[model samples]
Target: MAAVDQNSLRKLVEGQLLRLEGNAFQDCMDRLGLVLYPGDYQPVRAAGPKGDTKNDGYCPKARVFFAAHATRGETFAKTKGKIRGDLEGCLQEHRDVKVWRFLTNDTLPGEVDQFIDNTLRPLYPDVTIEVWGLKTLADEISKLKQGQVERIIDVITVDEPEFEVVVLNHMKTGRDLWPVLSNCLGWLPHEEPHDCTDDEQDLIDSAVQSFRDWSDISGDIEFSRFSVRDAQRSITAILEELAEKRLGLYAATTDDYPLTGGPSPFLGTVAIFRIVRVASE
Candidate 1:
């Protein structure tokens, strides 16, 4: 089988892996060197021994069994619990397969690593269990391919507001996006306003034009509405780009500068955005 594309790999993790038929997952696991147990069937719902639940695959050469945990209901802890039960069933049939490899399509809470150490590891002291969460796939894929990883990180946050949430899985280990992003904002200056050189002004002008290109300029335009809307979209596009690349952007209204000569009340303000990451976990 051909190597899986980035989009398929992304779909497997961030997308609907459960929707995938057994063969699709089998192919993906195969890329990672795991051979399916019931070689003739798909993995999504392949059956194991009569009493045991379905086992995705097993690499007989390495004494390892593969299981797919497609649960998005909660964190990896919940997923891990379910896998433990599956393992118990499988162990009844094949006690010789000591390694259990779980592939998950969910974001794991930071404490999950220690949980594995304290819980799963202690329970199966002789057996080795491995978890492949969002971060793990990204790490493995990056190592397999050379530089220029197609999928950097998966952002999984629907909770916690006070914290600027970031998972280092998508983090560009050798580079930073802040300076690159700052260069994209024309209105923002890298140095003091008065100290900008002619070349710097050219760069700023080029960025302004690039932002203008993002706007849908059709028909007669209200300059105020156009400028502000374009600015808003400019901010949005840059933010989305950064986020897609595993970078975080945070913005809050700061200052408002009132425009003159217009009979309208159009307040202009300078907003700033920054790249973010989790400093603690």
Candidate 2:
């Protein structure tokens, strides 16, 4: 596969969350124990493409706001305080708040952290307030990378258990299966196959070849074969130590159907299962 550009990848991840819908942003805030009121939380800014701020309407329910200069310490601190104050006023109006969450790419200064912890939190015991920095958001994005693969597994493993195994095998082929996969395998040479030994190398090679063959088939068909092929290749590589034993896998059934006029109809239902073995005498 083509090499991933780290800068581009970072932007891709950020793009997913640059301007979330107010409700979605509120949901995230709630999950992180951020405070919110029980009313319409609208955008304070104008309702056009981003950066078009000509309309001067008062956003009565502005749940999420992007601070412009988080890197500037003093300015960021003042802005955080101002935003926090606005949120506190909103809470006062509604009174039915669960939590208030702040999402940003920069860290809070020590004084600001202490102020929030010791002053604000105590004053509003009922409303929980939490902050998530860029590092935390990045970690969540990393998990999402794995989640995309798992979702494919879930879709493919809907009905038939045996077919799920096949789908899992397919998931192992996609490059960058996980953000950390490269980090884990970085020590090994790319040209050298994993495990080095004859039997292990054979199994790895077989998995890789299976993945390649299924690639085109996956595009033509609706089954989660492509995802499974990528996932399977990754799993196989990771579990090389257990090469001697037959691995068991499983997935749940799904209601989704494949699109028409693509390549081929998905052939069967897929389910997931795991294998447990007794010690041999």
Candidate 3:
């Protein structure tokens, strides 16, 4: 068998990631108790794409102005500048925007972290700026079960199950199907993501993805809730660990290394963490 092109596979994966990022972004916000009104990207327009008036979205629950940028091939530093520009534009144009929710396909880099902290937070002191980057996207994908991944693979990869049914029918009729089946099954020619025509792929992808995204109205709601809770826990863990170290450092502000340094009552609190880590190791 010929080796599949890694670059094509990557492009395919990135395409899917970007397309799904919006819903996943909404899911994360929902988990944080912010409910975005279902709508389009551009502001309240008379007619939305495909005759749908609701293409963009707004979060009344958080009073946020949401922006989705599924940038495929950009460094985080470049993306950060773009985001800063967009957020500045939003603030300049929309007086009602209380929170700036920026979602991107690129992972957040240290430059972006500094931008958010030293730039965004300080400059936009009156408004809240939240970013959902590639790591967040990965975490959302991680919550998808092995089963979910397989189900999607089954839907998009090939017509194996259909061919299996054909084999079963042949067996029932007691036909000599060895040569015929052998050639057909050989290499198990599969549908790569790029193989499907756009329309056909969209139909299959949407049906299968919808099955995963929305099993039923209730199941769909449950799936979103599960995603939200899972993401919240992941974010909380990172934030809490940072807060712990910062708290320790604050307690021993004068110490050379408050987190691992000269005596302070919070030192024992820090010590306990070290002991736990060593024990686990």
Per-residue CA lDDT of candidate 1, range 168-205, in tens?
Answer: 22323112322222222112222223444576446444
Q: TM-scores across all candidates?
A: 0.41, 0.35, 0.36
lDDT, candidate 2, 1-281, per-residue tens? 11222332233233333333344443343322221223543323335463323211122354332222233234746755754665565465444556455555455577767877888888879766666665455345434443342221121223322212223222222342222222111111113323356765575456434433433234224356566556546555644433344422121222222211123323222122222222333
Candidate 3 — which residues are off by over 4 angstroms? 1-15, 18-56, 138-281
Arrange candidates by TM-score, highest first: which order? 1, 3, 2
Please tell me which model should have the higher lDDT, number 1 or number 3: 1
lDDT of 2: 0.38
* Candidate 2 TM-score, C-alpha based: 0.35
Identify the superior model by TM-score, candidate 1 or candidate 3: 1
Q: How accurate is candidate 3 locally (lDDT)?
A: 0.40
Which candidate leads the pack in lDDT?
1
Off by over 4 Å in 1: 1-27, 34-45, 48-54, 75-77, 145-281
What's model 1's lDDT at 141? 52
Q: Rank the candidates by lDDT, best first.
A: 1, 3, 2
